[model samples]
Target: MTTCVITSHGGDFFGNDRHLTKLLTGLADYARGCLPADEREPLVKLLAAQQQTEVGTEQTIPAADAGQFAAQLRRIARHRYLRSTKLAEAATLLANAADRAAADGQPWTWRTEAA
Candidate 1:
C-alpha cells in the first residue's frame, strides 16, 4: 500500500492513499451539502486536488486558505457519524496543519510513499 503523508509544523499524519481518498471523497460530499455555496467550492477543489496527486509526488495546500480550511475540516470532523471514523481523523490532521500554518503562514505539504 502507498502511504500518503501530510506534514505540517504541528504534526504529521500517514495513511493508505486509497483509504484516504475514499475518506476525502466522503468529506467533499459532506461539504457540498452542509457548507454555504462560497465555502463549499474551495474545500471541494482542495480535496479533488489531493486525490489527483500521483504516488511519489507532492502537493501543497496554500497558507492563505488555512484558517478557513481548518475551520471547515473541524466542522466536518465533528459530524456525528464521522467522529469515530478515519475520515474524522484525517480531517483533524488537516485542521492541525492549518492551525500550525497560521503562525508562519506556511503551506501544508502532502506526499505519498511506499508503505
Candidate 2:
C-alpha cells in the first residue's frame, strides 16, 4: 500500500544544475507524507546532505559522482521506507543503469539505444 516516487533529473546530461536537489526534495516530501512523523527528520537530513553534495559550491558533480550519490540515496531510502518495495526496485534500476553506462563508456545521462 505504500507508494514511492523517485524523481528523474530531466535534461540533456546528468548533474545539470540543481537537478539532484529537486529530486531529493521531492523524495523527502514523499517520505514525510508516507512515513511516521518520528522518522521524517533523519530522512530530511539525508536528502539535504545529498542536495548539498549535488550542488556543492566550489565543485560540480560529474556523472560518476552522481551515480554514487544516487546509490547512497537509494540505501538511505530503503532503510527509512521499509514498506516501500518500489524504492528498492528504483534503486536496482539506477544501479543497473550506472553499471551499463560505465561498461559502455557512456555518460550517466539517459539514452535509448536499440539492443
Candidate 3:
C-alpha cells in the first residue's frame, strides 16, 4: 500500500502518525539499552576528555519542518545521547502539533499518551 502523506498547499505533512511515535519510542529504548544503567544518559558524562569533544550537535528542533527532523532523528541511532534527546524533542513537537490540530477541529494524528 502506498502510504499517503497528508499535507497542505505550502506546509509540510503532519508527521505525528504511528510511524513517528514508533520511531521516537524505539530509538529511546535503544539509547537506554546502549549504555549500562549507570551511563544511559551520557549527556551528563560528557566526553570532554576525548579527542572528539563535539557535543553531538544537530540542527535545532525543526518544529515546522517535521519531515526533516524525522529524517535526522532516524539517522543518529548510534549516538545514543543525540538520538535519545532528539527523539524526545521530536515527540514533543509532534504531540504539540497534534494537540493544536485537534483544538482547531482539523485533521489530527492520533498520538499515544505518555504514561
- Global lDDT of each model? 0.68, 0.45, 0.36
Clashing pairs in 3: none
How many clashing pairs in candidate 2?
0
| Per-residue error (Å), model 1, residue 31 | 1.7
The candidate 1 region of ten consecutive residues with least summed lDDT is 10-19
- In the predicted model 1, the residue pairs found to clash are none
Candidate 1 lDDT tens digits, 1-115: 5344445554524321233555566677777766778777988887766566677777677787787888998888887756457777777877777777765788766665444
Candidate 2 structure quality by residue, lDDT tens digits, 1-115? 2212222343226522222344545556655655556645654564444443422133223456556545554554566544555544544455455444444445554322111
Model 2: lDDT equals 0.45
Angstrom error of the Cα, residue 5, model 2: value is 11
Backbone clash count for every predicted candidate, in the order shown:
0, 0, 0
The most accurate candidate by lDDT is 1
Worst 10 residues of 2 by lDDT: 1-10
Superior candidate under TM-score, 1 versus 2: 1
Task: Kindly provide the TM-score of model 2 when superposed on the true structure, using C-alpha atoms.
Answer: 0.36
Off by over 4 Å in 2: 1-62, 77-80, 111-115
